[model samples]
Target: MNTRVNETERKRIAAAISVWENEGGAPGQDSMHHQYGRRIEADHSWTIYHVFTGVPARFGGDAMTGLSRMDATSGMLRLNLRNAERRRERIELSSFRAVPELAECGS
Candidate 1:
């Protein structure tokens, strides 16, 4: 069952993930959306993890259009660092902006 998702759908799914994160997850319960993604070395990009499985999708980089399509099975996707540390500080998934670590480079 290989379902082909277009760029629009990928962005839509990404938006859903964003919304799920912004709402602070499910009511009266803690949501693990924080583990959804982290800001990569690039600006405005992130390696977004699967909403339920926490697996990394091909979608990453260039927040606007880099999101990859979703397949029916996870085997078709790629795996990234499950727990990427952010300059010794935990990255808040809700904010996909560049991490403070990058700021140090310019200083």
Candidate 2:
């Protein structure tokens, strides 16, 4: 299984996350932490895993995680970016861990 989010999609996802973080988005709800998977070079879809720490205990306390299936055409990284955009709650990340593969992209 080639679970690699291509450079193009990775940047887009990173940008969206940056915006969400800067604007104070909530804990990802159904909007986040959902399991998603994709094979490499199949219909231009990609899969990436995200692990977030420093989240409030109510949300899951230091082990918040999610996966996104990115479409080449639509670029859907998170499960629901709209949900994240609507909320203005803050989440603190003491440490951020993306897939080891992403490190190659310097994410």
Candidate 3:
């Protein structure tokens, strides 16, 4: 990927990690009780990938609020956002094979 895209993905991953680390506690800790309010669980490996490549990604049950990478390769990272209801369940890249479709012209 391009340098600019990679850099942006790196920043996104860094921000996500910062949120996760700053929250403190293990991966499934009760972030709500903490000072930060809610802790965003981040995958270390995935974060690293995003830092290197600018691949966009969205994992976890609640796709709306899941973590996203900036590039395609970064999406290969194995950090799962996980589902809110199903705490044990993790959203993997393989599961999301359908890419978004482009808008049609003058529909």
Candidate 4:
């Protein structure tokens, strides 16, 4: 029930959203793997997830140091980051309630 949202975290979420929108819908399973691998190649500091169709997972930089996965059917995105300090700024599911369009595939 923590409602606190920081500016940096907001910006990061916005960036991730933009990336998801501009990249054309939630990635397919293979595309998701390739995208994550490419992103790791470009910047190993961040991780990616698509827990609900087109909704991209937004992790705190520190909260994404290790491994993660998005279970679309269960709407659960699990993260196993090594740093506790970085995991404090998670984007809750409530934040996405208003953006239902993100859950649909784009043409």
Q: Which candidate wins on lDDT? A: 1
Q: Which portions of model 4 miss their true places by more than 4 Å?
A: 1-5, 28-107
* Model 3 misplaced regions, further than 4 Å: 28-107
Off by over 4 Å in 2: 1-5, 27-107
Better of 3 and 4 by TM-score: 3
Q: List lDDT for all candidates, in order.
A: 0.40, 0.36, 0.37, 0.38
> What is the TM-score of candidate 4?
0.22
Query: Candidate 4: deviation at residue 53, Å?
Result: 23
For model 2, how does the per-residue alpha-carbon lDDT over 1-107 read when each residue is reduced to its tens digit?
34465777888999887555433345454545322222233443333223243221122233122322323112223433433544433322212224455555565
TM-score of each: 0.22, 0.22, 0.26, 0.22
Q: How would you encode candidate 4's per-residue C-alpha lDDT over 1-107 as one tens digit per residue?
A: 24456777888999997656433345454333222211231432334433334334544533333332222211222232222223333344444444678544321
How many residue pairs collide in each prediction?
Answer: 1, 1, 10, 0
Look at candidate 1 and tell me the lDDT of residue 25.
40
Candidate 3 lDDT tens digits, 1-107:
99999999999999887656433324356432222112233542222222223332334532222333332223322242322323333233323333333223223
